[model samples]
Target chain A: MKFNILIFTHATATHYPMNYLASIGSYAIMVREVFKKPTKWRIMKSLILKEIDDLIFGSLGIIIFISFFIGGVVAIQTALNISNPLIPRNLIGFATRQSVILEFAPTFTSIIMAGKVGSYITSSIGTMRVTEQIDALEVMGVNSLNYLVFPKIVAMFFYPFAVAIAMYIGILGGWIAGVFGGFSSSADFVEGLQLDFIPYHVTYSFIKSVVFAFVIATVPSYHGYYMKGGALEVGKAATVSFVWTSVVIIILNYVLTQLMLG
Target chain B: MIEVKDLHKAFDGSPVLKGISTVFEKGKTNLIIGQSGSGKTVFMKCLLGLIIPDSGTICYEGQIYSQLTPEQQRDLRQEMGMVFQGSALFDSMTVEGNVMFPLEMFARQSRSEMQDRVEFVLRRVNLADAHKKYPAEISGGMQKRVAIARAIVMNPKYLFCDEPNSGLDPRTAILIDNLIQEITREYNITTVINTHDMNSVMEIGEKIVFLKDGIKEWEGTNRDIFRTDNEAVSNFVYSSELFKKVRQMYLEERD
Candidate 1:
């Protein structure tokens, strides 16, 4: 049993690296195809507009709701954790601002969007695959990747705008919670929000949001476009897409933070 | 017209299409008939350039497929239209949008001209009233018609149908088959169909190629099929008791 288990483990370890690299290579090829043989602008305009509605507008409600509540929770937790009387009450607002801007609004919200938008991209495209609609596009001599995935990548360029809204709403939630909960004065909370506010931090957050947007759009699309099999497999591909998108985003967040903020 | 010369394909070292040579003529309904796993789909997909044959050449109107540049291949693809087994209508688009998609992609016509073409094709497929309906909103038969309308809206020289009537009822299937035949004759399009439906073979088969184990077992017309004594062909053609009796009657009537 031990010998058999060791062999199985060895086989799996060797296979996954090659498989992972091959998947990345295939993803690069698909992205290249998306740029070639461009769909006519007249038709692509409508497609890009529809995608913006589906991916951007559709995601606003959840991003706002989660950012608000999480902002409140961050303020409350920061207020509770400061045991030293020497520490200023304004630190609660500072903590909320930092958390929401640097991580929550951009990275956290993106992880959530992975579930909402990522699964959607996968299932829609996978369903097209299962029903042979993708094949139909290819048969018509249309670049299926350019037709299906390019519009999505274009619409996600507006994702930073959504993240900016999340940042604003989060600070408001922090203010409301801090003052109303008797944790701090409204004047102090707003003061802390402006205190030492690095303009570059907002830029960094927007930069991260933009990077996450590409990851969100392309990762799910790669899964959906390459997936084979039937209806059951579409559901499976959506789940797998979500996992991979989240993993890539988290890894990218660490790398970006280390480079930009270290 | 399309010509396949010594075509071959295999998956994981197991052959699916093996050294098959055939000619699919223009202005005729050329049917490829076979049982399941007989490489019908693979052969059709190869012809569609969706699959690369392991060996051999597919010449479309004397433009050899493999030798053409990518741009040339894409240009060739625009002149070909295909109807998939599931109709494969874009669920997101209405019937009108589905039919108009090809024109919008490749044609430089004005919006009114494109609209007129869409309307004409929809009317041709008897789907004039269902223009605004989405694929999910309509019945399967109607979706097939929309697919057919889309396939022809670009005015393709070659029309390919992969089991175009698989899920349809007998009456609806026959209507779909007849519609394909009429369109083929009307436009003088080179129509290639992949099917296992004996009804379709008897009805629209101007030329039939029978594949067994990835090899061309027989080649003939629907009428000639009734008289073929090739054991495998006879066994397949008369697999059902009803077909056996019908063939006996056909032979006796000929006698």
Candidate 2:
């Protein structure tokens, strides 16, 4: 029994890496299919517009809500951590600026969207696959991947705009928290926000946003498009997509930060 | 006409289609019927080029599927329309939008012209009034009609339906079957249907291929089916006691 258990464990351990490799290979092929032989521009235009509405415009409320509270929390935390009087009150603003712009607005918001937009893309496409709608597209001579995923990639061009709004709201929330929480005066916080504001940091954030947007769109699409089984599997695919999307975003966040800012 | 020569397909080393060959004639409703696991769906998919056969050739009007280039295959697909088992209507689109989809993708017509074509096909499917309703809002029968409308909107030269009447009642199933037959005749399309509905086989099956365990067990017309002595075909065809009695009555009345 012990030997049998050992063999089973060994087999399971070896199988997972192979599965991961296979998934990666399939994902690469799916990406190639998405770029090949696109549908007519007129139809694609409408699809993109719809995706923008579904993925970006629809996500505004949650992004705004999360960004505001997290910004306020970051400000309060930074203010409380400073024990020395020599540390300027305006330093609260600087901390919030660095935290929100460099990481929170771009990376954290994407993690949230990896759940929201990622699940939506996966479940919708997965449902289509389950119901043979993708097969229907193929029978009609439509490039199903190109028709489905390319619009998503195009729509994610607007993702940076969502991130931008998050950035602005985040900073504003920091101001409100720092001034009203009595940690710092309004003037000092605003002054700190404007001081040493590196234009390059904002540029870096936007660049990260673009890459993260592509990951969010394509990863979930890959999950959804190739998913087999039925409605239950669609839900499972969505959860798996969200996990992989978040993981990819965090890893990319680290690598991109190193390449751009290191 | 579509000629499939010794088509073979397997999944995960288990053969689903084991060397089957048949011909589907133009302007006729050809039915592929079998028990649930008899690989009818797999056979239809192989014909549609959705699944590549492990061996053998499927020729669409003499152009072999396996030999065609990707671009050629795509062009061939443009001439084909398929109705999926579950209707496969785009839930996001209304009836008009669903029917207009193929035209929007393939046809280059003015807005008015596209609308006209959409209207014509919807009315042809007897869905003239359900244009604005979404697929979810309609009955199963109506959804099947919408699927038919979508499939025929492009005026395809070849039409394939995968269980068009699977979820429909007997009356609606006959209506859909008749509608498919009418369209096939009207358009001169080489229509292939994958179904297990015995009613469809008896009603509109101009030609029928019976599959058992991935092999073509029999091939004949509906008229031939009534007279065939093949036990497997008879057992399947007359499985229900009602059908058995009806077959007895049919033979007695003929005698």
Candidate 3:
């Protein structure tokens, strides 16, 4: 029994890293397949439009609501933490702007979308895989990857627009909270918003949004397209896709920050 | 005609199809019948180029599958149609959209022309009123008909059906079988079906191949099946007591 336990532990320890590596290799292959000679432009155009409607337009309301509330909370928290009179009153607004722009809008919002849009992509494709719809495409000689995933990648090009909206709403939310809640004066908040504003920061945020958008689109699609088994497996694939998408986004956030803005 | 030679496949070292060789004739209902684990699905998938065999050759009209370029293979696939067992209709599309899909992908017809073809195929399947209904809203039989209509809309030169009668009542199953047979005759297309339905065998099994454990156990026509003495084939085809009795009566009548 002890020997068996030792073997089991040894096997598991080796399995996880190997599995992760295999997944990364498979994901790279899937990305390559997605860029192969596509279907006719007419068909692809329709698919792209449909994907945009589903992934971008459908996600707007929740993003708006969450961004605004989080921005407000950030401002209030900043105000409460400032006990030193040496710090300027407008510093509350400055801190809120930095946190909302740099982290909340791009990184946190993507983590949320990794749950929402990622699950949808994974479930839809996983269902297709289970029901043999993907097989049907393969039998028909259609490049299933190109047909299914390319449109999603194209649709996520519009994801930055959603991030842009979140940024705007988040700053507006900070304003509403800081002024009405009496955390900071409106004049000081407006001054803080303009203080030390760097144009490169906005560019960096947009760049992060674009990269995160690619993750949200493709990672879930990989899980869905290659999923096997039945309905239960589809749900499992969705959960796994969400976890991996979020983890990748967080890791990429750090790596990109160091490379681009360190 | 489709011909497979010395086909072999293995999944993770467990060989599913050891070596399979068969010829499916053109313009007839060629049925592949076997027990559940007999590698029938794998065989059909190999023929469709959905699964690459570890070692084998599948030839369509004398052109080897592996020798063809990817573009040529795709061009060849356009000539083939398949009806899946579950009637794998796209849930997002209505019956009309499902039928029109292949045409939209391959055919360059105008909107009105596409509409006319879609209507014609739907009418052929006796689904004239089901144009607007989603697959979820329709009966199982209706969904099968819609799948058939979609498969044939492109007027393919080859038709494939995988367990075309599963999950249907006897009456509906027979209807679907007859529809496939009639379509095969009308189009003079090579049609291959994978099924274990004995009823389908006796009704439309013009050329039948029986597989057991991935090996071709027997190959003959429906008429020959009753007379064959192969133990494996006889045991499978006459497993039910009712079928066994019926076979005895059939032989007595023939004598």
Q: Residues B1-255, candidate 2: write the lDDT tens digits.
A: 999999898875899999999999999999999999999998998888888788999998889988998878888998998999999999999999999999998898999999999999988998899999999999999999999899888889899999999988999999999999999999999999999899999899999999999999999999888889999999999899988887888899999
Give candidate 1 regions above 4 Å deviation. A1-18
TM-score of chain A of each: 0.93, 0.93, 0.93
Please report how far candidate 1 places residue B157 from its true position, in Å: 0.5
Candidate 1 displacement at residue B85 in angstroms: 0.9
- What DockQ does candidate 2 score? 0.46
Q: Residue A89 error for model 2, in Å?
A: 1.7
Question: What is candidate 2's local distance difference test score?
Answer: 0.90
- What value of lDDT does candidate 3 attain over all alpha carbons? 0.89
Supply candidate 3's per-residue lDDT for A159. Answer: 93
Q: Alpha-carbon error at A58 in model 2, in Å?
A: 1.0
Give a tens-digit lDDT track for model 3, residues B5-71: 9999987578999899999988899999999999999889888877778898999999998899878
Q: Which stretches of candidate 2 lie over 4 Å from their true place?
A: A1-17
> In candidate 1, what are the lDDT values of residues A1-262, reduced to their tens digit?
0111222332343358655655675677777878989999998999999999999999999999999988999999999898999999889888999999999999999999999999999999989988989888888889888999999999999999999999999888888888999999998898889889999999999999999999999999978877777899889889999999999999999999999999
- iRMSD for each candidate structure, in the order shown: 9.0, 9.1, 8.9
Q: What is the fraction of true interface contacts found in candidate 2?
A: 0.74
DockQ winner between candidates 2 and 3: 2
Clashing pairs in 2: none
**Candidate that beats the other on TM-score, 1 or 2, i.e. the better one:** 1
Worst ten in a row by lDDT for model 2 chain B: B45-54
